[model samples]
Target: MSATQSHRGVGSAVALPPLSNGPHRKRLGLVALIATFGGLLFGYDTGVINGALRPMTAELGLTPFTEGIVASSLVFAAAIGALSGGRISDGWGRRKTIILLAVLFFAGTLVCVFTPSVGVLVVGRVLLGLAVGGASAVVPVFLAEMAPFEIRGSLAGRNELMIVVGQLAAFVVNAIIGIVWGDVPGVWRIMLAVCALPAIALFFGMLRVPESPRWLVEKGRHDEALAVLRSVRSEDRALAELGEVENVAKEERESQQIGWRAVFSNKNLFRILLVGIGLGVAQQLTGINSIMYYGQTVLVESGFNESGALIANIAPGVIAVIGGVIALTLMDRIDRRKTFILGLALTTSCHLLIGFASMMLPVGNPIRPFVILFLVVAFVGSMQTFLNVAVWVYLSEVFPLHMRGFGTGVSIFFLWVVNGFLSLFFPSLVAGLGITGTFFLFAVVGALALVFVVKQVPETRGRTLEALEEDVTTGAIYLVHKNQG
Candidate 1:
């Protein structure tokens, strides 16, 4: 039960515990459903702008430059939220942090709905961004810590599924409101207002769910941790897992490697942080968010009129939800490394096809818009299916328990930063390079991402978080494949 003993056992075979059924399983399912409301809010807040932007531009007099500012301001703030939210969650506890985020979400939504000018709207978005970023960093970790290793992938992945579902809801609502109230002034406010309902739900929901058992253990509240664990796990398995967690937690405390200082000074911790950051960066560079935030613009450039593009944008959102469902089913069955490799390959190919279609079909061609739309949908579907959920789940589980929050927060900060830059400049890129040239650039970036995954990303599937933590902290994770080969 010592740290040395646990570290030595990292390479040994450890069987996954059987999933418990009955009330305990239902309790776990309900917790996942409630917590992922954060993901839902993240999706709706980020995606609502896709349809709302056109009408908002007309009413608010948003020049192209100012439009970029309005769109990306939330993303930039999210980067700040993500970096700080992780550390805050570590100190404040995951449950309390999520409750605070819910309050932010509701307040931010109200601000956006009521704001009369561009400046006020930007301020409102910054508030929402902080909540979104915090949820991105915290929700998956909460789910992962709560789940049994047997179903951790799917359970944690539900947050991503909820995210896409929220995005789809935004798209559907935008289409309904935009078409129905096409003549109504400030219809976009209604679109922004709908998210407040889920924010309220998340607040109340967190109050009912138990704090993460692993987090309770980390704080040295052993009896409480076991109590929470028993609600979701079989009693015998709960006790056994508690022992494993305590052994690792003890070693982490004894070593005194817990925060940013430890991350920088320890070579293994630093390498893994880089890997997490790399994964985050790679996911954003796929150019998926570019479509999510500006699908209407992209479709317009491909030849659809503004109204047509607004409706057409729903295609990608629908495909994204479907792909997320598919990905969740495969999460536990497939190797994490294989999912990354295949996802990168598929998404990169889709990018190339979209670029070529734009060049070869031309804007005036009758089929051009439809072709581009199809390719965009394919790109989104591939990303949702293979990259999005898998990346979040991997990031949540890859770090040592002591530094999980810091590592996840830092990695997702880079993710949001890349996404913000892309959102900010996508208009300029489209205006200058045209759809063909812009997507070609994304294709090139996608190719490089494929290389990064094949070379640097480690396999995390089918391992307990503690075992994975052991390998990650000692740098043994990188050598596992080679030794097996």
Candidate 2:
């Protein structure tokens, strides 16, 4: 065994070995680019609706209640998608699962682009939702399983970057189409159609990428796992890593009581899964999607004209992309728990400030909209910078290799469900409660989320997946990092 040095934290010392050295940067970078196309599809499909919805409602003769349903339909389907996709990826392998998602993306976009009725359009959105949910569940794990421990954060976080970039693409596309062809019937279809080109690219691109080696080992394909590992790591390191992985897989198989029953029967596995669920639910409760989904309405309610709100909506998307970039740079450098806590803190504060500003400023004040907009943008920046990437990375890493997909799926299922319900009822929420009330509600949730992170979330930086897996399987990973510096 490698020599270990004792690192002191608040009340204990952890003798952690050095993290695995990074592997071929160029090889891994290319793999990330291919995998993250799923994220792009995710961002575009969800966000295109942001700008496209206003025109869509007018064309479809949608009631406000129906508007919420149309918006939430994709999200509800995404919940199912994340659940099913997680299980599918666990069985089918991550790379193949992603390829399937690409096909769904293409078909979903095509359906939405041509749908003449509300019913058909919803079916398309649900298809797109499946693609989005699958991408969200699998891409991070794909990257995580491929990455070296030392740089896993940055490498895995590229999916979040791609997601936000896709969102930004939607915002920009919606703005262009809205400006040039705003009055044209079915311009919204053009916005939805933009996703199809990338889907084709994703399908073709993934054909050349390798499957996750850890998953290969889990399936008893040791030789195949070694072969995949060699392309990403030095030959000697690849062999060493394979040896470690084989040992774990053997222990898991020997223990062999797996499935939902096994997961619950094992206390450590169940506890960690709950933490993952908490993280997922907490993220959505921040209310970030409300802005992404109903931003124009929020902006208009804050006083801007519809045209101006469409243009101004781009600001949050721009900040989201920029925040994603900054987040990618910081992931490997910062401890995961701190980033999460800081994100929740900032997000919560923004909520309170937004609520307070809206109340004090009231309606019709020229500065009220601008101030609330600024706070909302600030909240988006905080979330994209700290919360989004870290939460995804944490979900990818916390589960045992045997159950990574299922665990992440269940957690994210709840996340998407929370997101869906919020999206579904947000128009109602705003109408019932208005900006001040809605924001204060977010503020309350944000405060509780802040506490959850500080008390429950574990730090996962600078640790090998294998090492983390060992600790997690034993319940030590949770206890060790819960208070560690």
lDDT of each: 0.91, 0.88
Name the lDDT value of residue 423 in candidate 2.
97
Q: Against the true structure, candidate 2 has what lDDT?
A: 0.88
Q: For model 2, how does the per-residue alpha-carbon lDDT over 388-466 read when each residue is reduced to its tens digit? A: 9999999998788988999989999999999999999999999999999999999999999988888887777876777
Worst 10 residues of 2 by lDDT: 1-10
Q: What digit string (tens of lDDT, one per residue) describes model 1 on residues 71-168?
A: 99999999988988899988889999999999999999999999989999999999999999999999999999998876789999999999999999
Number of the predicted model whose TM-score against the real structure is largest: 1
TM-score of each: 0.97, 0.95
Q: Candidate 2 has what TM-score?
A: 0.95
- List ranges where model 2 is wrong by over 4 Å: 1-23, 257-259, 482-485
- The C-alpha RMSD of each candidate to the native structure, in angstroms, is 2.5, 2.9
User: Which consecutive 10 residues in model 1 have the weakest lDDT in total?
Assistant: 1-10
